[model samples]
Target: MPVLNPDIARAFDEIADLLEIEDANPFRVRAYRTAARLVLGLSSDLKTMVEAGEDLTELPGIGEDLAKKIIEIVTTGHCSFLEKLEKQTPPALTELLKVPGLGPKRVKALWHELDVETVDQLTRAAREGRIRSVPGFGEKTEARILEALQAQIAAVPRFPIAVAAPYAAALVRYLQNVPGVRRVVVAGSFRRGRDTVGDLDILATVAADSPIMERFTAYEDVAEVFSQGTTRATVILRNKLQVDLRAVDESAYGAALHYFTGSKSHNIAIRRMGQDMGLKVNEYGLFRGKERIAGDTEESVYAAVGLPYIEPELRENRGEIQAARAGHLPKLVAMGDLRGDLHAHSKASDGHHSMRDMAAAARAAGLEYLAITEHSRHLTIAHGLDPVRLRRQMDEIDALNTELDGITLLKGIEVDILEDGSLDLPDSILSDLELVVAAVHYRFDLPRGKQTARILKAMDSPHFTILAHPSGRLIGSREPMDVDMPRIIRHARERGCFLEINAQPERLDLVDIHARTAKEEGVLLAVNSDAHSIHDFDNLRFGLQQAQRGWLEMKDVLNTRTLKELRPLLAATMSR
Candidate 1:
């Protein structure tokens, strides 16, 4: 068995969850949690490092004990520490952490008080009106729990795109290395760049004698082979992500790719277009009666239906077909189009790296300028900067810029938008910065009207430049705050401040629908990494994918403009 970084990271996270549920030391729990994050964010493979006998303790937040645990997980595919913790607490209690509003503390309370060790037990308790009496849980909390549980039950388990990417990329690389394989591609929601992916649809064009299926099932990470055939096979990975692989002939590769890389509605719409033209479309090819019309390329498939080639990200049947027909399809923003990132952080706040390191990283990532937006005073958990600390950091950035080249660092703060709609720090200090990435770090449960008003009021500030992670959502964990997003977009257009399409995988907020609405409203959106470390800049690709899905073009994105063009636009937002 090959242990990936995510495997090690998951072990650490589960250890943290179990520790928390046992009411263990908070610092010990935080240490494991931090170790998990560090593992997940590493660019290189931990297994490779372990194989090379590298010292893991050199990694941030990875101390002597934690380094040993990492080696144990990598070498043995299990963590003795986590196994021990699981024995002290019901291992299933960790699954309760998946429920939106339930944290480990709540799980512990449920376990000790209500004897609720699983979601099913919690669900029954909530339904029987027994949860309301469980100390901290009230009737409303119980009701919300029931609703959340039901939603969870109804939803298919989908991996966040970030979580699934490594597995998908590793598999693609493995298959590509197999003898007789010509090409391999992962197409599905992954191709569409959806925030969460249900499964991976992999297609390979191979020589007739290819042993792709045999090798695929034999891959180290494959947990179980569901079915196997010469041309097609299905399996589940160790992480439980289902994957389907198909060996396609070169002649029909494009058609197979398009068929599998689909939103069902989009595929149906394309098929109907083919039908109207007296043609048939399927996984193999597009045909007019007995003759094949198009199937060799995705462009040919679209041309057969009298449409231009639609980008996979736009293949959601969301007016894309109509736009293509009218020749109004957007060019769509790409990773190369971005000129700078407006929302980022450093060690001055909760970020793991310093401004100098982050700048060099942004330059390496091809950005001409990077904004170091540390969290402001209100977020103590992040060691957010006070006005004095913020000023000192600004001075540091100014000095670093004098010694640096290629990339410029902009001084800024991710100042909290207070409950009453005022900035966390006073305007006097905020006005001194190049930008303010105003955000809501707390009070996510406000009424729709109040939440919208709070955000709108914050944007009213002359110093406010962009709203960071505008919905404050963490996919599969935290739901988006209740608010009128269209109203927020319209207000942003009216007010001059921009909304952010935060690129962080967990917080791809200002989702595709909202991004499109902002575009429609003629409001520019910044597809920012909201990066906390150098590796986070890689997340910008996810943001770009999200923007493409929203039908955004380079001109529609704020940060796509060069620094010279962006400063004036940013200035307009700040002094409006």
Candidate 2:
């Protein structure tokens, strides 16, 4: 029911795309991103003012065009430039830009050199030994590029809770073993239950020893140590994510935990408050009452200043403090309440395994069941299957169902929602699918009104079950599809359709606030991982975190049923 300020995430996406699109000044684009980070930290809605016709650009860091876009979204629910920009960009090329470390500069170079517009072509070029021969590329770089490409292709776009949970547990496991370690806990976005993890933070109390920090970094799993010190250490795990470990003394453990387990800005505001009270705050004890009255303990630390424990997602240095001060902090969802995964893929589309492989993974995670929604014919690069292939996959599911044990599989399709919001597949074809995860894969650069209408039209589909990845977000790469999400969520609820909380790291599409809004509207959510491989099914952890961060619960979700029960939910639409 609240309007979100998408500026920071928006700016990061656009600036990266501007780089890949090879449009605009690199410096100016960089300004948008720098501004985005700062703005994302601010909790107020730029839209409310924009809707009042105020020039939001007067706010430091926002430019005129950016202000205009804010106005457009607030007023009409879309951005013109983002829409135009997307229209000009080939969706295939946009997906290509998502390869980590491969910016628009490199993408443009590849496009210019090999005339390869898609990942598949680029992969072929990299593998057959053609890409490295080009200027600005060589053997080692080529190998790394190919490896990244292989990862992008071979891996699922998302993973589930079952896969990431163990790693989170293992990462937590390692920190607990540190000598002198006391009360170490996982923090950052993960603790808040996000849909994906970029890094892990562990807060603990040690004797504050150099030897302990050294031992912590010297652990066998430590692939590379970025920094090491008496009370702090940063290292990379086998996964490329960064992990920051902080240590404090026993007396100050809780204070240190609150400080180090911070979303940074959350800590900063507390320090500022401490400063206002003539106290100094750090990973050490809260230096108030001069005798350092506040000893270690997050509650004691917050209680020292009179506040409740803040959720990490809400801790983005936003209005959380003011809200907490007023006893109005937003309630966030927790992972234990999530039921099942909705959007997943198998070898059926561009996935690594069969439907049975995916369902088994879900069951193992104690999930009720899963919806195997493979890509439709529109996504040629993903090898979206045709009608015949679709039928064959259904038969496969039926065969597996007869022999099934616990979790069941629902037959679904990630159908393409065209620029006009029409189903890319015919009604007859759509009629057979148990669930439809429709998405916009093309013409993303349309005007605000059109983009909103485009999506709304798709939701109007009598056969449509869920809107997949409502925002079409690709973290660090692409901007959201220019559509009015709150409006669409409201519309979907009215239409008896559900929205997807895509668990993919790049496209946690139904982000926290949006998911919360859907819940308020009483719309059911399909928390899907969009997994293309067995590993991706594990992204459900990230998805659950995200959904919880938005304050979603098990009852708000639809796919938490056993596969047999879920099938009827979808098939009932046909009967209607």
Candidate 3:
């Protein structure tokens, strides 16, 4: 199988993690980390680039040595250097880092002091009070680790939707190329646009005598085939993502797709509705007393239940069926509905691309305007802007705006909201920008009441235009801070400010539930890409899906308005 960009990136990350655990050279460790980020952020496939004989060294942050490693990974589907390092280090140490609050230092400490090399060992130590005995760990730390371990044990391993995308696309394309395949669709949480997917459910229609099952099992990426039959198969990919494929007759394609693409609760609800209508719904077809009625298309399936087609994203049984019946279903916001992106970054801060490059990329992405919201002085790691630097960048944007035609750049700052609810930058400086995207970057573990007040106070600032990633959660890596989301949503409405659905795959904050609350409270949400690189604008697609899943319409999205329409609304928020 071809090594996809994500696969290559993961290998680099593992190497970095293992090296860090071994206390290897800081520069060497940093190089692999940077390379991993560069690969993940690239819009093109590294395998294709390698096949075209492109000079990988020409890519920023990738040197000759890394270039050779990329080639080896792409051509052979494995990295010799990573394998050697894994042999040297306790490979499980890398997995230990996945525990929240456990970094390389702690992993190393645990391994050396407690002889703990695995989660199971660590869990046993924590439970036995051995973890607190480690020099740096205390009773509270040990308690938190134990709690995290319990949650981890109970949770099913799932990949972020973005992480699963390339694999699914590759598999679907492969299946579609099968000689006898007539139709191919991936269903389940993936089709529903869930934040993370536990597994892939694929449905296909093939001609009689097709050898699709054989071809699927023989695919290069298949690490193991658990089961195989004439019409169905299950396999685990090399990356450990499980996949189940079902080959259905052309007449039953829709029924199979609907059946497999489901939240079990949603499917049960539909089946109950079918039962009331004197109908039977199954993977084969929707029937009335054994006479097949509707199964040719999803639309027909919905029609059989006397309802209009419900989008996969709305099939979570979250009042969508009722809305569909009443003809009140929202016209979910589409990617094309956005005219401007109100949150983005440039190289002036932590972003990778220059202002001009980011502006050009946004224009190419069909955006009429893009906000350059660089980080402020509080975020030193990002080389965030001080007043002097911000002013210089604003002047630069003014010059670039004069030269640009298709796109306009809005001056903005992602100012930090301090623990005391004060803005990182003074109002004098923040007032100069077209937007102020306030964010909470530290103290994520504040008491619920304090956290809620902190955000509410920040929103009280006249210059606060939007709260970026309101929940401050990193999907899998970090849990959201304890805060009153309903109160925050209500405060935003009263304060005439907005919240953001930050589009970074790992930081898809303002999750669907909060987004729905914001929409219901008459508070518009900005589905911003939070783009750090030019290619990062692509993340807006995921943001749109998040918004759609929240039942947001174009009207509920702040950026869907024309730039002319947006300016007044923004100005109103910044007014005293």
Q: Which candidate tops lDDT?
A: 3
Model 3: weakest 10-residue lDDT segment is 34-43
Return the TM-score for each candidate structure: 0.97, 0.64, 0.97
lDDT of 3 by residue, 368-403 (tens): 999999999999877889999999999999999999
- Best-to-worst ranking by lDDT: 3, 1, 2
Among residues 3 or more apart in sequence or in different chains, the pairs in candidate 3 whose N, CA or C atoms overlap within 3 Å are: 188-261
How well does candidate 1 score on lDDT at residue 461? 90
Q: Please give the lDDT score for candidate 1.
A: 0.90
Residue-wise C-alpha lDDT for candidate 1, range 237-314, written one tens digit per residue: 989999999999899988999999998999999999999989999988999898998999999899999999999999
In model 1, what lDDT does residue 347 have? 73
Model 1, residue 181: distance off in Å is: 1.7
Error (Å) of candidate 2 at residue 104 is 9.9
Shift in Å, residue 320, candidate 1: 1.3
